[model samples]
Target: AQTVTQSQPEMSVQEAETVTLSCTYDTSENNYYLFWYKQPPSRQMILVIRQEAYKQQNATENRFSVNFQKAAKSFSLKISDSQLGDTAMYFCAFMKHAGNNNDMRFGAGTRLTVKP
Candidate 1:
């Protein structure tokens, strides 16, 4: 069974600063995908970034990026030039590339508060 762990239950970042959220996972499958999903106050889960296990380069999207350490099974998200709108509950998710029933496992999530 695969599981994602987000050690931080809550995080705060000042506007215009950078914040990194820690995430670690346990999995034996060699081929899989890791994702960072952001759920704002509206409760919409937005795909922040995704990393393929086989890819050496990390995934990035605009002000969002991920530090993917496949060997250690560590995938963390970094938010640059954070804004108040970035505040949300962020979840780390995992799914096998094989797409078995399109099943995906999500972490408990970390509540991020962006302060002005």
Candidate 2:
């Protein structure tokens, strides 16, 4: 069974600062996908970033980036220039590759607050 772990339960960041959230996982599958999802107070999940196990290069999206360590089964997210809008519950997810199909399992989540 694959499980995602986000050690940090909560975090706070000042506006325009940067924050990094840690995530680790346990999986036996060699090929899979990692994702960081942000669920705002409204409860909509947004894909912050994604990384494939085969890709050594980390993924970045504007203000978000990830450090994906396949060997260690760790995937961490960094949010730069954090703003009030960045405040949300961040969930790390894992998806197994199934012949062009995929299903996701998420961590407990790290609730981030951006203090204005």
lDDT of predicted model 2: 0.94
lDDT of 2 by residue, 7-103 (tens): 9999999999999999999989988899999999999999889998999999999999999888888999999999999999999999998787887
Question: Which regions in candidate 1 have their CA more than 4 angstroms from the true location?
Answer: none
Candidate 2 at residue 8, lDDT? 100
- lDDT of every model, 2 decimals: 0.93, 0.94
Angstrom error of the Cα, residue 43, model 2: value is: 0.4
- Residue pairs with colliding backbones in model 1 are none
Models 1 onward score TM values of 0.96, 0.96
Work out how many backbone clashes candidate 2 has. 0
- Candidate 1's displacement at residue 32, Å, is 0.3
RMSD of 2: 1.0
Residue 108 of model 2, lDDT score? 98
Q: What TM-score does candidate 1 get on C-alpha atoms?
A: 0.96
